[model samples]
Target chain A: MGDEKTQVHFGILGCAEIASKVCRAINLSPNSILRAISSRSIEKAKQFAIKNSLSESVKVYGSYEEVLDDPFVDAVYVPLPTSLHLKWAVLAAEKKKHVLLEKPTALDVGELDRILDACESNGVQFMDGSMWYHHPRTARMKEFISDPTLFGQVKTIYSSSSFFPPPQFFETNIRTKADLDAFGALGDAGWYCIGAILWAMNYKMPTTVTALPATIRNSDGVIMSTTVAFHWEQEGTTATFYCSFLSHETMDVLVLGSKGSFHVEDLIIPYEESSASFNFTSGASFADLHIGWNMKEQEVQVHNELPQEALMVKEFSRLVKGIKDSSIRPDTKWREVSRTSQVVLDALKLSVDSGFKRVYI
Target chain B: MGDEKTQVHFGILGCAEIASKVCRAINLSPNSILRAISSRSIEKAKQFAIKNSLSESVKVYGSYEEVLDDPFVDAVYVPLPTSLHLKWAVLAAEKKKHVLLEKPTALDVGELDRILDACESNGVQFMDGSMWYHHPRTARMKEFISDPTLFGQVKTIYSSSSFFPPPQFFETNIRTKADLDAFGALGDAGWYCIGAILWAMNYKMPTTVTALPATIRNSDGVIMSTTVAFHWEQEGTTATFYCSFLSHETMDVLVLGSKGSFHVEDLIIPYEESSASFNFTSGASFADLHIGWNMKEQEVQVHNELPQEALMVKEFSRLVKGIKDSSIRPDTKWREVSRTSQVVLDALKLSVDSGFKRVYI
Candidate 1:
């Protein structure tokens, strides 16, 4: 085992837009291989396999369950709509296969907890597929924030991720249907804001949150547009976030402190060609929109041109191979991620139902 | 009546810090005179009158009712704590006097509605003391927004106003008690956010709102911080606002449009000494924030250099003197302002009680 390179064969549950990128990453990596692909339609699965030039070795399955039952697959990536994340993640765990579930792992906390229990009981490794968290820029951001000389004492955080949704995407899709645990901007984009805030605030769930959800509508009636507010606390710090699906593409996160501030421009999907950079404050005096240090100069450039999904897959492979030491187990972090998502979604639901009431966690 | 130079004698209901400037303005203005001053203590009232050089002409009263009852006083300025605003404003109305009440006219809607009714029945002017709304800059801002060639189509509106509160101010103050109509930063400073958003969005009440409020508390259980998300909808337009009292001093308002963007720097309180300017962007093209045809000109300049309270008094004096039109009564705006505040505060309370449930108007 020491001399031999560990190999993990992977299958994808539903071939969504994000799955293609993950598949490409798996095919390119030496430690992992794309063993199978599945979709509700066999034609779609076959086309995916043939297009990737994996038809000779990779199997195509019509039913997601058939892919999960394959003994050759060591892990499965679930990129189904948010509503189905819990079901397939639990099934993969039951089959003794590690699972890499996409962002907003589940729609609510109750379901998320059940998924965690299933994974733990089966001794299956589970990881939330948050590729941004695996990127070097995220670590650099954490480091810059912790540095007293650079940021002084951390104070507030503001983030926004707004983009125009495809016109057809909002009609009866799992992501837009309220009965299927669908929320518009907050569920789709607001999770990023919540995740970023929690990460910067040392994983402290906001003690309370008061949100104003935008009144958005399609032919279908009122959908959420934007959520804006301050996340307050009895202790620690406060943060603010704005998320929208009605605007032009924008992804930025800014962190403010007493002495200076640090921000990551275009955080959602990093600019395709270059490494993400942070703008830090240079001096004691504050100026509008300033940047200070480069992580590359500090020798923190872990991966230069690798795709974000590739980086995440590489990290997950290392964790499964027992080559990486982690403070929280991959399984534990998976549960925590899902739980945090539920807390945020639940709070947002409460805000919407109660006409933007401030809810305490 | 025009030749008579009609004068309206004004009085202070509480010798609060804000009242001092009002006294000075009354002394300076040609159409109004400071007739009386009152505080809980006669000694304090006398000291305030003396400090402002109201020596022999201005009468000092021990109780607030005495000032309201004074026949010489045509209007009374109420700068009392939030809890006392409704009671005193109603009392002043009953005395047949016009009233200028500070922001958060009342903590809840019921109290605000009663005050409005009393003022209407008594035929007295009732204005929320948000004097900044009366500044010439506001008119200029409206003009900029209305001009299609300048701003094109308005898209998004963002505003934030945050400042630290004195330590003693949080202890048992009317602004900090939730049951007593005190509700953290939302009540203290978030009201300004409401006013700014309503102003920018053309005074449209939100069709729906979803908010997340922070649980902010001092050592003695006073709420010190809050963040609120207000999603407003009218026709097809939507706007978002973020307001807090816990963060550092920041006052910024940004309005993004399809063809261009307009930004108001230090919106709540612009620098008095320097010129106030904003940036306008139209797609790839950009220009200085303009009001009508002007570019890079000062947006908010008060040539008189008077305190905000003084500016408010001077404007009210002009209204009384028939030199300025009173048709745009502040009482009309106060109704909406107070109603919005009630909705927001009620939403905050519901959020806290229901563990951050979605609330509706």
Candidate 2:
């Protein structure tokens, strides 16, 4: 992913580790190009550019303001800390730059609403950095679960997104700092769980959100791990998700329906870059004598030419290009997805903070 | 499996649907034989024997008392409903017949205790018919999870057991009758979920059992579906399970540890009879650039000469033979396993009955 023909110029407002991945995605996308990168220190920005082997033509800036002020930049990918997202994302939108904000979009729905309002008023397209939605495998899974005969109504869903971080992370990582990333693992890893569940439910909010009593927190009162459950009364569907920084690496989601079910072990990142697969079964039942299943779970494989992150950038740039070239407005789908996920995340937070009470949505 | 050389003669009380499967298993095991089959009516017993293609040498008893009175019968397989377990199991034990009981072992632990105590006092062996426990795959999985470095400490576990039964099943099946199988799906299907979770935790009782508010019941006040949670305060481990007769067939168990994880889509009954496999990954981490996994989950296959039910019969017969010939005491392991499962099952029922309150174990 060296450099692609540029249609939309992109600027990154932070040097977070995730920013490096997005920077490459910008360069790889067919209609987007990396224009600039900024950190608090110009020296640090230069080091980050060197570390990621950025092209010489890509500008390096000392502060985020410089990137927003650059007239050529059409979009900004904000990978800043959670506490800084409201300020930086609104500023980018006000500067008339489309925004790809990292998740959990903001501290709470109030901050998310302010950011969304700014993007709407400024007429700038907004999307979160949940790259998995752009993976072709995701679309394939949705197709399977959406089939009336094959999948029927969803009965239950269970998702897990976790990783065991090194001991040093507790001492220095911004996620463990209340002021920097107060939501901690619930914001970092739990974002994917919420997004996956919401995606399965077609972004419909849950009737209730309840945190399990096993929430673990750091000394700074920042969550390190938690489990939450969601109930959709109308659909009679329930979902439970566990996100943690203390468990081994896992990005798994299982959805069971009346007639069919599917499981994906690597939902966030495919085990391979070029292809991914999930186990699916339809009309399964006990074989005669109850000795075995009537059907085995078939592994349905899906291939993609580009990685999910690149597809995400390509999709975002396509929306930005539409508004710039024609009179078309921004697509509201992505913002709505982010907003629903944020609202649920906020409810889970409230449930945990209130001694594991069940919070109605 | 034609009749094997007979060592431990088995007389089945109640020609329930599951009895046919176990009937075949008895004939398949090397050291076991089906000596007698019984039902309340001799005609029904004759019908069951004919339908299952039982050997002419197997006797058709008019009543369960007739099977127990036969001095040649060394063991009895009881597939009677939960309401009849206490009366029949204790009677079989008192008759000096080893007991192979179908599970949700009894209506409650109190009844299960009486059955176990009768077996102890009569010096007769006891085992519940949970066939999966005897599968070689179960032993292999136990090895993987026991490894200190490869699997590390168990962090969380999730189990699901569900199937969408025919509508007629809800109307006429014994499971739907209040007095026949009071626990309904909770006793029949949820039994496997509880057994699997406890098996993974080495049969330790959970600190607390909490049933979610999603319990669905039939008109007879029998639980048809439910979701429950278990927390092990000492190990900092949490487990959740969903069991129902209202979803597609699934017997899934997922165990996540500090350094490894595994998922088995078919835990109760394997997808195949001759061999089964589970997806396992140990010491897995993100690949460079967080684009993919460093290692893919490996599918570990385990093969068995006999099916799981046959293995279960063989194991139970072996223990019975040791006690009958060598004057050795009956093995306590099987009874202990059944006791723990019944204890947890009772807790789940109590939680559901008490308005989804958390029950301390």
Candidate 3:
């Protein structure tokens, strides 16, 4: 968060496809340095480094443990499949390297809790790799929704994330393989939608989660597409989301309060890397004779100095630096939000398995 | 449809708030003329005519039957409450006056069927007053989703409409009165959402309809806000929608297909009265390294020569003129689509009443 001198050194576990994005992010982040990368096949790891044009100073490791054992690596980014998250993340935390894990953080909340405990016991930072949370537009949108006078009491939200994967991905990708990702689309895409709802509620978990009818799964019992609804009884707020790998790419979030609403079409990834915009309306009443709106919605554009993932890396690195130089405790907000998001995801999956039943959390 | 000389004359059944919008539409439509208006009190009807600046040739009647009985009036526009639709619409059909009925056409499918039967027997045209269906943007959007190469198979749709009504309106309006608009928010706002989904699916009804949990009701047992999910097993297509009267006003329709998506924020009422725009993406693929999209979504703008409601009036008038001049039988497509939409709404209401169970339609 301060200067490059206090930079946090990061080593990535596994040369997964997503690592390319994160590797570039680590390079772009001012307070973060790419230290190493490890993969089961050292040849694949070397290829990835060369393809991504990594600096010559960055070392490549043959095993995940080699990267974690490196004393110079201040933190580790785990982009492996969901099944390997628990073991590698816990091992990294136990090794006293701050952990930034890819989302659907675990197979279930129990595993997520175990990883959090490891980080807590070892006094290292923990953060889920949900890049959208670090976007500057996200903070601005939150400020608008939280305004009582302009937005009123938040009442409802609808979020969805979907992408039509290639035919080969369905047959060969780890996401569709049950033992590898297990939760499939629910774990991969649904995680972002669930996190969106929780983030809009300011980390307040819903009291009930109900799966919508028409959940589709592959032959291997992996969810391909589904929709779920959430209810917060005390706040009288409700949210619903649809996720899938069988549909076109779409990521949207719409939040409605008493007096205003906030809507964004590309929530997961902005349409442009340099700037993003969202629609906001306050006190929108009907026009004369109700033919149109009396108040026009404002499309507020937010400029980004760095990409969202880079900002995420910078934020995580800042926390790791605080623990290293200032003896500061790790931020609990990130851990709490990630844990609550996983809890909702588990309840949704349970509801789907139970035939669209309402699951109380 | 033929010429202004063959213009169809219209009579309004009540001075409902919606009538103000339609009255102007009838005047703007070249093939339609507002002939008369009726209310419980003649004074109120006269005041409505004056307030809407109706032509001096337009007559004012004290009773709905008076307008239906007017032989000079070729069609009757029924904007009465949902509870009054069956009685008034059936009477208008029996009088051989083609009927344009406001949405939430009937309390349930039984009443809708009765109204349809009366229209069929009398050889009169019937159309629902969903103004958005007439928007030029709607037709263009449909053309995109129906494209196989650009959009592919339509897999899912999400539609929602909500508005924060004044506190007093909830207490006094017919929508919140169980005996008047018995379905409440499900009738008022849910109708448009259901219609949007049905329109996207080419008016095909889903096999199953399930009400989502988090349904809120007033003390009168009228729904205040709710969400419903629709599933078509044969087509492997699904839809979900949320409707409310207690939250910030929002109208959004998002359709996801195999190759592209169609999204509109203000589906029901555009931000402007003259033209509207919607976002469409075709072949949206992830960029290299999956950091962003390769192609940006295009915002397609559609200019309207006539207001949506005016276009609706013109279309209805054209059908009325065809039946009157050509001795043609009533077009069944209008009745069929309205019937399917009502059937889905009935199933959703039944599901909600039965504790959010799946109702097979």
Whose DockQ is greatest here?
Answer: 2
TM-score of each: 0.62, 0.98, 0.97
Model 2 chain B, TM?
A: 0.98
- What is candidate 2's DockQ? 0.73
Rank by TM-score (best first):
2, 3, 1
Per-residue lDDT over A86-190 for candidate 1, one digit per residue giving the tens place of the 0 to 100 score = 788898989977888876777777877788888788777777776778678888778878887656555667776665555676665555676554666677677
Candidates 2 and 3 compared: the better one by lDDT is 2
lDDT of 3 at B289: 79
lDDT of each: 0.64, 0.92, 0.90
In angstroms, how far off is B293's CA in candidate 2?
Answer: 1.2
**What residue runs in model 2 are displaced by over 4 Å at the alpha carbon?**
A1-6, B1-6
Give the candidates in order of DockQ, highest first: 2, 3, 1
User: lDDT tens string, model 2, A1-361?
Assistant: 4335448899999899889889888878888999999999999999999999999989999999999999989999999989999999999999999999998899999999999999999999999999999999999999999999999988889999999988998999889999998899999999999999999999999998888777889899999888788888777678888889998999999999999999999999999998999999999999999988888989999998889999999999999989998857989999999999999999999998998887899
- lDDT digits (tens) for residues B240-309 of candidate 1: 4444545544455666544445556445554442233454433321111100122221233434355344
Candidate with more favorable, higher DockQ: 2 or 3: 2
Best by lDDT: 2
lDDT of 3 by residue, B1-361 (tens): 3354688999999999999999999999999988899999999999999998888999999999999889899999999999999999999999999999998999999999999999999999999998999999999998999899999998888888999988799878889998998799988889899999999999887988887667889999999999788888887788888899988888889898989998897889888999999998988878877777887789999999999999999999888888999998898988997999899888988998998888898
